[model samples]
Structure formats: C-alpha cells, structure tokens
Target: MAFSAEDAKTASAVWEKIYADVEDNGAIVLSRMFKENPHTVSYFKNFTQLQSIPETASAEEIAALAEVRGHGKKVFSALNDLVSHLTNVDSLKATIVPLAKKHATELKVDVKDFGIIFENLLHLIGQKQGGDAKEAFEKVTNLIYEEIKAAY
Candidate 1:
C-alpha cells in the first residue's frame, strides 16, 4: 500500500475538513466503534467504567465519557499528523513507528482491530464528506493502518 501522488493531493485537501470536524466528531467516531464492538474497549483501562454507565448519561455524569472524549482528541491529532506525512515514507514511519510500538506492546491493540477502525472511519467520512473526499479518506486510512500494522 503505497501512497501515490494523487492520493497525497486528495488527502491533503480532505484533511482540512477532517481536522475541522475532529473536535466534535472524534467522539462520535469512537462511540460508533464502541457501539459496534463493545469488547474492543477492553484495550482501554477504563473499559469497565465506560461499559457500566447508561448510554444516555451525560458527560458530567459519566467520567469515562469525558476521558474517552480526551482520547478522541489525541487519536484525531495523531491521525492528522500521519496524514500530513503521507507523501514521505520516512516521515510516515517516524510517526507510525512509535505509535505502533505503543499500541502493540502497551495498549495491546491487535493489528486486526484497525480494520474495524477503517470501517467506522469510512462510515463517518461518508456521512460527512462524500465523493472524492471519501475516496481520499480511504486511501489515507489504509496507508495509516497498513504502515502501523507492519510495524506492530
């Protein structure tokens, strides 16, 4: 999975919208993942806390929700950083190598889980930005996942 010139151009443009939406949309993306694959949250330390809360509970009511929201910001930022370096393998590796190590060793996030991330991300991108934007997003997502999986 190489990043072609066209993919870089497309991703560079689409990333702006993604960056803008992340603050509000990141949690939604993560929430969708949690809703779809509840067991996946086991990778996180607060898994039980997040699961115990009622779905309708407010952020203030459930501390785990707030913590997850914070995690969403970090995820979005890392995604943005990775996409920003799509044109250069060295730069991309620089970003992914440490993240891959951390995720695999410390977080214990399996490489296969990235597929779920990709699917949910695709859904989120389609709902917010369709057409070429979705295509670009897919390329970016695949690159990030593939590179990270390789390292992990």
Candidate 2:
C-alpha cells in the first residue's frame, strides 16, 4: 500500500521522536521480536544464545545483549533512511532494494521473517508512542515489507 503525503509526514514526525533514542528503542524492538517468536533467532547465528540468556546474565550474555543493541541500531538506521525518503518512491525503492537483496541472498533470510519484524515494530510503536504513531508507521512498514518480499 502506498502512503499518502500526509501519511509520510505523520510517520516522519513520529520517526524523528523514536530515532532520537534509536539504539535503545531498536534493541527493545529486536528483543521483543526474539521473545515473541523464538524461532526467528535461528536466523541470527551470533544471537542464537539470546533466548538462553538469563535475567542475571553472565559477561558473555552481556556482550551478546550489547551486540543485539548494536545490530538494532543498524536496523533502525536503515528504517530511518527509508522513512526519510517516503515521499519519493524511486529513492525509497533504490535504498531498500539493495538491502533486500543482501538479506535475501547473502543472509538467506526467510521472507516470512520480515512479517515478524513488522509486527514487532508496530507493537513497539503502539506501546511507546500510542496508536496514532503506530497507524502512521503501519503504512511505511507495509511498504517496506512488500518491497522486501518482491525483492526476495
């Protein structure tokens, strides 16, 4: 689904708020994704131990969590780039296609995993920012997922 100009504007404004603390928020989204769908962890070799980490984590677990946070930052940064270009479909598609190809080919990420990420991200936005932000982001995320699926 294509986002209207107003949808893009609203999503961009909300994204600015989230991106201010992208590292922490992104980590929360990824952590929530793993928790909600344990099967998805198999795709991340480095984070395979994520599910096994205890509340009182060991130093190793701490390092793993830190890595997850770092990866989360990268994930959100990519999203930020896409959201910033929402008003220009050509620019957005150019930016997303390469990353989608990398995930599909290099990472061998299952297409279904994108849906998991989309749902988790929406949940995070709804929980932290409220329904309006979630609604705005939903369109952007749907586009992202659709583009990725097509690329795959």
Candidate 3:
C-alpha cells in the first residue's frame, strides 16, 4: 500500500475500471481476467505470498504474519492510508503504476483486470478465515476496496 500520487491515481482509476467491469459483466468476467493474464497471476501470487501465511507456514510464520497484522491495523485506521500515501507521486509512481503496467504486459490483460484479481484475491482470503479473523480481515479488506472504489 506504499503508493505515491501517480500510483494512487492509477490504482484509483484502475479500481474504477474494475468495478465498472464487475458491474457490467460480473464476477465471472473478473475471474476470466485472472485466468487469462499471466502478469495478473504473478502479481496476485506475489501479493498473496506477501500478505498471507503460506500454505505450509508454521506457527512461526503465523507469528510473523501476526506482526504484519498489527501493521495492517494501523493502515486500517485511516481509509486514505490505503492510497493517500500516493500523494508522494515519486513513491507511488515508483511502485504500483509500474506494477500495474507490468501486470498488464505480463498477463496480457488490462490494468482493470489486474485490479479485479487483486480485489477478489483479498476477498477469497477473507472467506478462508473464520470468527474474529474473518471479521477483522473482511473489515480491513472492505475498507481498502471502498477507498479504491471511492477514488473513482
């Protein structure tokens, strides 16, 4: 979520595109974008690995992720924290937008498709947890998406 102004603009705009596609074509289309794009797949795979405990993650892994969880909470405290950092155009530009472009190229998909896959993967993670973890994860995830959606 270390976005710069341009990254924010790109991410925000791309999110709008993804939402529009979802609104117009639905989740299946979004899923198709992931299936069709390899860059999107790589982006998603990287993001998932970064954010979640791995499939074979041990208790130590869980503990490490727990620390990240606290860091995630701080980001959750402010909605704009999701992309507001993008006000620093250099940082944002350095990261997300390029990734977006790379995602489009690597996956042979649109930036919007990459966005939808990112969003849905988060959704899927939320679905996998139960009770408090589910609730907390969904809340943070929904907040992040809502901000991305609002930027449109």
Highest-scoring model, TM-score? 2
Tens-place lDDT per residue, model 2, 23-51, is 88887777776666666677776764565
- Give the per-residue lDDT digits (tens) of candidate 1, residues 22-112: 7666676677666667667677756556767536555434433776677777888888888888888888988899999998998888888
TM-score of each: 0.85, 0.87, 0.29
What C-alpha lDDT, on a 0 to 100 scale, does residue 117 get in candidate 3?
42
* Strongest candidate by lDDT: 2
Q: Give candidate 1's whole-model lDDT.
A: 0.75
Predicted structure 3, TM vs. truth: 0.29
Per-residue lDDT of 149 in model 3: 41
Candidate 1 vs candidate 2, TM-score winner: 2
Worst 10 residues of 2 by lDDT: 54-63
lDDT of each: 0.75, 0.80, 0.40
lDDT per residue as tens, model 3, 1-152: 33445545654553333233332223333334334443443444444543353344442343244333343333223323334444553543443454345434554444355256445434533444434343433433444443434333
Those runs of model 1 whose alpha carbons end farther than 4 Å from true positions after fitting are 47-49, 54-64
Candidate 3 clashing pairs, residues 3+ apart or interchain: 3-86, 4-86, 4-92, 5-86, 38-107, 39-106, 39-107
